[model samples]
Target: MNWQDEAMRYEPLKAQDLYDFATAEQKQEAVEAYNRAVNKLRSGNGDVAGIALRQLAAQYPDFAEAGLLSVCCQMLWGDRRGALQILQRFSQAGYLTEDESFKTERYLAAVSSEPARETEDPGAVVVMDGENLRRDTVKPPRLLRRASADSGVEVASASEQEAFLREHNLNLKKHHYVASRSSNLLIKWLVTLLIILLLIALLLVVFLLLPQGGKTGAAATASPGLLNWSGLRLWRPVNLFQA
Candidate 1:
C-alpha cells in the first residue's frame, strides 16, 4: 500500500494517548526541553529556538505541543514548507482539531489552501505510514494542562501569536537605515541653519562697523586741524587782554 493508503488504515493518535504511554521521567524531560525552546524563542533567537524545538519534537514524537511550537518557529523563520509539513503530521495524528487555534493561524491559511506537492520541499508532502502515526488512542494527560499554565508561553489567539512573531521578525536593519538617514538629514539642516544665522550676524556686524567707520572718517575730514588746538586758542586769550 502507498503511504497515503497506509496512513488511512490507522486511527489518528490523540495527545492524551501519547501522554499515557510516556514515563514520568520522559514527560519531565519533554517539558524541560520545551521550556528551554520557549526561552530561546522569547529571547528573539527564533532560529536557535526552531532547531531546539524540532529536535525536541523529533525526540518526543508524541509531544504535540513541541511539534506545534516548532511549526510556529518554522513560520517565523520563513520556512513555510517545513511548517506545513509539521501541520500535516499533526493533522493526520488528530492533534489538530476543529477548534484548535492553528486552524485560524494566518501562516497556514495560504499553505493549507494549496496543493502540498507544489511546495519546493518535496518532503512537505505528508508521510502517514511513518512510525510516528502508529499509535493507540487514550485519555488526555495532565502534562498538557499543566504545561500550558507553567510554560510561560502566552496562550493568545492565533492572530495575536502571529503578530508577536512578526514583531520579532521585523527587519532591524531597515529600521536602522531609516533612523540613520533621518538623523543625518536633521544634522545637515541644523548645520545649514547655524551657517545662515552666523552669516546674518556677520553681515549685521559689518554693516554697523561700516557706518561707524564712515562717520568717524567724515568728522576727521571736516576738521583736519582738530588735533592742533594750539593753532588758535591761546593767542585769542592774550589778545583780549592786550587790546
Candidate 2:
C-alpha cells in the first residue's frame, strides 16, 4: 500500500503474526505510522493514536518502538492491565530496545507497588508518577505573603513550587541526556555512510577524469620528425644520412 493508505486497513496483529515479520521497507512504513500516531497523541486524540500504535506493534512484532508508545498511551489513559498486556506481548518477543526495555521494567515496578495518592490532581508539586504519595516534604521558607489567587487555580506553597521546579529540571536533564545519546548514535552512522558514499563518488570521478593510456604516445611516435624538410609546395621526410 502507498504511504497515504489508512493504517487501520491491516487486521490487528496480522503483520506480527507472520513468522518473517516485515521487510526493512515495510518496517519503515510502520515507523512512519508510529510517528503519525505519536503526533496524534500530542493533538489530544490519544484514543486513535493508541489504537493505531497497538495495531502497528502487533502487525510488526519486532517494531519495539510501536510497542513502547502503545504502552505509554495505555498508561496515560490509566489502563493498567491493558498497558501491561501490550508490554508483556512484545517484551516476550524480545524486540524492545534498551530504553524501551528499561521503561517497561519501571512500569512493571510502579504497577506492582502501591499507587502514590499525592499526585491525583495537577499541582505545583514535585511528585513523580507513583512516588512520594504518603511521605510529607518540609515546607521551604516563603519570601512573601500568599496572594489572593484566582478561584480556579490551585496555587501551591513556595516550597511545593520549588520542589516541582527542581524535579522537573532533573527529569528534563535526565531525559535530554538519554535522548541525546540515542540521537548521537544515529548521527554517527549517517555521517559514516555519507563519508563512504563521498569517497566512492570521488574515486569514480578521478577514474573518469584520468587520461586513457598510450594514445598520446602512439600518435607522437607515428608522427614525422621535426627535422623533416618542407619545400615551398609541400612537406617532405628528411633522409639525414644522405644529406
Candidate 3:
C-alpha cells in the first residue's frame, strides 16, 4: 500500500493499546499511530489532538510521552499556570528533561520577581514622620528634610532617580546599564533565503519564456541576404520574372 494509505490506516489506535503492546512490531505500530495523531494536531486539529492526548494521559498516567503531550496541549490552549504546574510536577517526578527543567526554573524566577501591585510615584513629596520630614525618594530616607532646604534635600539632578522610580514604580533602586552585542545572524540568513528564492523565481520565469524569446530573436535576426547560397536560384528566378 502507498504511504498515505498506510498512515491513514492506524488512526483508530488508542493510547492504552499502545502501552499494552509488548512485541516490537506492535510497539512500532503504536508509535506510528501516535505520530499520525501528532501530525494531525500540528496540521490544525489541535483541539482534537488535545482530547486524544487527555484520553491518553487518563489511560496511562505514568507515561512520559502522554504527560509531555498534555503539557503541550495546555500551553497551546493558553493555560500557562496549568502548564507550569504540570512542568513542576514532572520535574519533581524526575520525568522532565534537563532543558524542560531549565525552562521551568526560568519561568518561575521571572514570575516571582514581579511587584505585587503598582506603587505611586513619589515626586518630591516630603512627608513628615514623627519629628522629621525626609526626602521620600530614598527607600530608607538618608537625610531628614527638616535639616535640608524646604523643596527637599539639595540632591543634584534627582530626575534620573525619579525617572527610574516612576518607570518601575519603585523608590530609589539602583539601575545597571549594559550594552549587548547585536547578533543579527537570523535576519541575515532570512534575507539571504529571500534573495535566493527571488533569483530562483526569476530563473524559472526566464526558462518558461525562453522558447518564445528564441523564436522572436530568430525572426528578428533572419534577413534575405543571410540565407544559404542554395536559396539564391529561387530568388534569382523571382527577380527575372519581375524584370
**Residue lDDT tens for model 3, 1-243:** 121232233333454444332234433443443565566665654444444454444333334454455555554444445445555554555444464456456544543353333432222333333344333532211112333344534432455334422332322122221111112344678899999999999999999999999887566447442443543422222343554
lDDT of 1 by residue, 20-137 (tens): 3245555555565566556555565445455556656655554666666666555543456776766665554543444334542533565566454434421211111211211112
CA lDDT, every model vs. true structure: 0.46, 0.48, 0.44
- Model 2 misplacement above 4 A: 1-21, 90-95, 114-243
Better of 1 and 3 by lDDT: 1
* C-alpha TM-scores of all predictions: 0.36, 0.36, 0.30
* Clashing pairs in model 3, backbone N/Cα/C closer than 3 A: 133-145
Better of 2 and 3 by TM-score: 2
lDDT of 1 at 163: 40
Tell me how candidate 1 scores on lDDT: 0.46
Clashing pairs in 1: none
